[model samples]
Target: MNFTLHQLQVFLKVSETKSITKAAEELFLTQPAVSIQLKNFQDQFDIPLTEVVGRQLYVTDFGQEIAFAAQAIIDQVNAINYKLAAYKGQLSGRLKIASVSTGKYVIPFFLSGFLRGNPQIELKLDVTNKAQVVRSLVDNEIDFALVSILPDKVPVHAVPLMENRLVLVAGRDFQPPLGVSGIEIFQYITLIYRESGSGTRLAMEGFLNDHKVPIKKMLVLTSNEAVKQAVMAGLGCSIMPVIGIKNELKQGDLKVIEVKGLPICTYWNLIYLKSKRLSPVAEAFLSYLDREKNTVIEQNFQ
Candidate 1:
């Protein structure tokens, strides 16, 4: 099978994302183009590269081996690019990073500064749920993941980047009684929550379990933006990151409703699989984040 490097890259990306649509978006190509190329690549081999199960795409066992080989090739090419750029005294390579929905509020600033400083380095950012971010970590799909709750089973090195606090907030019409127990707070108001796989939801659940609050009525939304909108519309109160609600707070669209042991405080962790090997660009970005994240967060978030 005579496959070009582009084809290998397409295959690897599709495998990593498990979605041709997402792979196309990442590759800056149309869905049909990606599908055509993948079909051609698959046609040359005897084994099926992938299969769809329950409307979800999955790589076959043979495809897994092919993906590993393709990654090795890609890594070597990146290494060569890194070495050549270093020879010219510059950093250049692609960086893939995934972050939880809440981190989406602030991670762009971090990337913007880095991009201005390293114009040659490319970035692909995916703002998704905690579950997808964790899967990305496990599959080595990204160089870094910004999340508050790291999966316990994933062997990852997590570095604290910024403060993340989930607070109970309500619109002007919905008055919440503050200075109450965590248990009482839920009883008094209809709680809006992010999806189950979200870090915000997980944190809220942990707090509820700790306080022995019963699982009660909730309005679950799929995104932080959705929850924010729902809160602003006075549909219900929600627990969300302070970073996400800065504008709402300043614009007087929402107000913080305090509860005892509330606003579950957690640190935003920049994590990657412990066994994953980072490219020069990834390493440089990590160093840059380590050195500048706190300052950037302080300036942008506050």
Candidate 2:
């Protein structure tokens, strides 16, 4: 039996979303059109690739296997197209990068110039916590990882992009007591913290331990935005990257609390494993960074 690449693509999307309607929306096709293509693709295979039960679609175990193979085939085809474009002197390829959640403020500025210069490049950026970002890098799921704290466990090369400063901040209404200094100030207010394995959490903890600060109350949140909102709501003060809180600080919604040895500083690093081979697109990005990082940082971040 013969099946076309378009059919394979439809089936793969169907398997991923487990709903013809959703697959069609993502693929920019009508539901009936996608359903008909899926049916045609299934007809060629003796074994069922998908099944429906309880009014919901599910990819069978075999269907999952086929979806994996389909993904590889699609990737290869895209690579061939990119290579062909390169032969015509146009740089084109997919560049995948995984970054910690707070890195949102940093990575995009660095990417803007490169992406503009290479109009044909497809960029896949995954903004997650440090643990997941590191996992993606170690598993070879991405070409690069953006982080502020280096993963000591991984053997990798790091390119320091810019300074990342974390400051302890409270809502606009917070007022310090008559005479409190250094770590003693922590006793006056609750602390908002990120979840375990977050780079921000790690750095906050390191600072607390180094100063032997005693926390009276603590609240754990899963994301930077959530923590920022919680702090803005006056739930508690949190140590957060200055870059992430620029708007809040400018609007007078948040205020940085001055204490001795505050504003923990770290370098935002673009890292990749030492053993992984760099793609042409990745190499080009490195060269671009070398040439433009300083200008980009000065223009946008300063």
Candidate 3:
């Protein structure tokens, strides 16, 4: 209750960047100054906000909870300023949005079109994996989130934006077994998988679990591009979003497996805190998403 906005801002930046040094550089402050500010803020509460693991600083669970509240406070304050400025006939403000890695392929296209019509608005986009996206949303660091999988317990409102079908893709040179049904294709090749905490990974795991596919020898990677490259190199096969492999498919660099009862299509949702009041810029962006959701999905997917 007694924290200053500057302290909250510093905390948010550090949490987002995961480094006090990097956060200080971004905020144009010295590292020691940033550390002092963070220490001062942490002293107000009984529990420590950050924990050091080896050389890295990580936000503790308690810290994360406080950070979430801090973000809401910051957002509300900005919303008030935006409202006052809007009454004075200024419709200019920055909107920050975080999205899952796959969303990078789709959100920018929609954002470009939206920006064309509203030149006064500025956008700050953070492209990361699903876990980071959820964390940012929960912390109020992002105004909205676009992700493939929704968390079980979210303090936010989420709306289904589009349904994505996962596809099994392989290099052009890799040959799938002949005279086999789609469900049987899994027996022919080693599976390449995404790292833990990935939405795509979670969806694929759920699908395999439902189908009872044994996955003891699958190779795991941290990036979609890396998975694609590995597939192209004939390292292994992977299940990926069709959107991520559109160009590869078009170029014949990869081929989608024709599998029946596979892929387990999932919905990508747009998420925002349920109780937080949105600023005009954030509200306009949300409206744009609602209006153009179908069009964007069709244009990108089909």
**Which candidate number maximizes TM-score?**
2
lDDT ranking, best first: 2, 1, 3
Model 3, CA-based lDDT: 0.85
Number of backbone collisions per candidate: 0, 0, 0
- Alpha carbon lDDT of residue 188, candidate 1? 69
Q: Tens-digit lDDT track for model 1 on 1-302? A: 69988999999999999999999988999999999889989998999999999999999999999999999998898779877887899888889999998888867888888889987787878899999988887888789999998788788898887788888898977755666654576886778888879999999888888888765578889999999999899888887889888888999999988778787999888888889899888888888887898788778876
List the pairs of residues colliding in candidate 1.
none
Error of 3 at 60 (Å): 20
Write candidate 3's Cα lDDT for 1-302 as tens digits.
48789999999999888999999998899999999999989999899899999999999999899889888998788778766767778675778889888888767877877788776676888888898888898888888888888787887788787777789888999876678657777777889999898998998888888888766458999989999999999998989998788899999999988776666688777788897789888888788988987887778666
What is the RMSD, in Å, between candidate 3 and the native fold over all Cα? 6.2
Worst 10 residues of 3 by lDDT: 176-185
Candidate 2 to truth, TM = 0.87
Compared with the true structure, what per-residue lDDT tens digits does model 2 show for residues 76-180?
999899989899999999999999999998899999999999988989898999999999999999999999999987999999999999999999988877787
Candidate 1 vs candidate 3: which has greater lDDT? 1
Question: Could you tell me how far off, in angstroms, the CA of residue 286 lies in candidate 3 after the best superposition?
Answer: 1.9
